[model samples]
Target: MKEVVYNSDLHFEHKQWNSELAFWEDELKTFKNRLSELVTRWTDKEVLAQLEHYQNQFILHGGVIENLQETIEKHETNIAGHSQKGDESMDVALVKKHSEFRYQMEAQRQIYADLKKEFFRFLSKYM
Candidate 1:
C-alpha cells in the first residue's frame, strides 16, 4: 500500500489496499537470481540438445583447424614445412599437390565453405 501525502498525486487516493507492496517487492527480489535464470533459457530439451550438439561440432571443427594451423607453423620452421608449389625438389611439389588435392576433393562435400557460400547466394537471389 502507498502512503498518502498532500503534495503527492495519491493525496486524494483510495485507501483500500494495505501496505503489502514492500512485502511483495522483497519476496520477488529474493528470487531474482533463480527466477531470472529459469526465464532466460530454452525449455524444450530436444531443441536445446540439438542446438548444443551443433555448437559443439562447430567448436570441435574450429579447434581442429587451430591445431592444424599451429602444427603447420611449427613444421614450416623445418625443411619439409617450407615446401610450396614450385620448390626445386619433386618431393616438395608432390607433398603440396597431395595436400591441395585432398582439400580440393573435400571441397566437393556439403560442408565445404565455397559450396555453402554459393548455396546462400542462390537462396538470397530467389528468396
Candidate 2:
C-alpha cells in the first residue's frame, strides 16, 4: 500500500492566523510523539540519528511558526487602528497597510505549507 500526505486548512476567514498557527503546532506535537514511539523500537544507530535530526528541524520550525503568529497579530492590530478611524474619504495609508498585512499573511502561509510538506514526507517514509 502507498501512503499519502494529508493537508488541511481550518481558517474560516483570511484573518484567522491564530487557528492556522495552532494547526502547525498540533502537527509538530503529533509528529514528535510518533517519532519517539518509533525510536524505541528501532535498533539501528543510523536510523536513530536520522530521527533525531528530524526532531531538531521540527523544533526550529516550531519557533518559526510562533514568530509568524506574533507578526500576524501585530499586523492585525495595526490594521485595526486604521479601521477605527472610520471609513473616511481617501485613506490611502489604510489601504496600503491592509494590503501589506494580507501579503505578509499569505507569504507566511506558504512558508508553513512547505514546512509541513517536508515533515509529512519524513513521517510517511520513515515513521
Candidate 3:
C-alpha cells in the first residue's frame, strides 16, 4: 500500500503521460476524419445524430487533452526549477499534487478508452 503511494521520479511519469496525450491528440485527428467520411457515406437521421454525438465528444476530449498537456508541461517546468533550488517543502507539496494528477490521468485514459471502444462498435454496426 505504501509503495502504491510512492513515485521515485515524477518526471518520468510526466514524460510518459505527455507522450500518451500526444498520441491521443494525433489519434483524435484520425477519428475526426473518419467521422467526416461516415457523415458523407451515411445520410440517415439516426446515423447523423450519432455522428454528431461523437463529434461533440471528440471535440470535448480534445480540449481536455490539450488542457492536461499544458498542465503537465507547466508542472514539469516547476519540478525542474525545484530540483535546482532544492526546496524540500515545495517538493513535498508537489509530490502530493503529482499523485492527484496521476489519478486524473488514469481516469481520463479509461474514459477515452471507453469512448474509443464505443466509437468502434458504432463503426462496426454502420460502416
Q: List the residue pairs that clash in candidate 1.
A: none
State each model's CA lDDT, in order: 0.38, 0.66, 0.86
After the best TM-score superposition of candidate 2, give how far the Cα of residue 107 lies from its true spot, in angstroms: 5.3
Looking at model 1, report the run of 10 residues with the lowest lDDT sum.
9-18
Q: Each prediction's Cα RMSD?
A: 29.8, 10.7, 3.0
**Candidate 1, residue 5: CA error in Å?**
90
Cα-based TM-score, every candidate: 0.37, 0.65, 0.89
Taking the tens digit of each residue's C-alpha lDDT, what string does model 1 give over 2-96?
32222111111112111222332343343343333433565667645544544454445444444444444343433333233333233444345
**Top candidate, metric TM-score:** 3
Which of 1 and 2 is ahead in lDDT?
2
Worst 10 residues of 2 by lDDT: 3-12
Q: Candidate 2, residue 20: CA error in Å? A: 2.1
Span of 10 residues, lowest total lDDT, candidate 3: 1-10
The better-scoring model by lDDT among 2 and 3 is 3
Q: Clashing residue pairs in candidate 2, if any?
A: none
The digit string of per-residue lDDT tens for model 2 on 1-127 reads: 5332111111123247678778879988988898898799888898788788878878887887777677656655554564467522224554455457567768967876886687678668766
lDDT of 3: 0.86
- Model 3 clash pairs? none
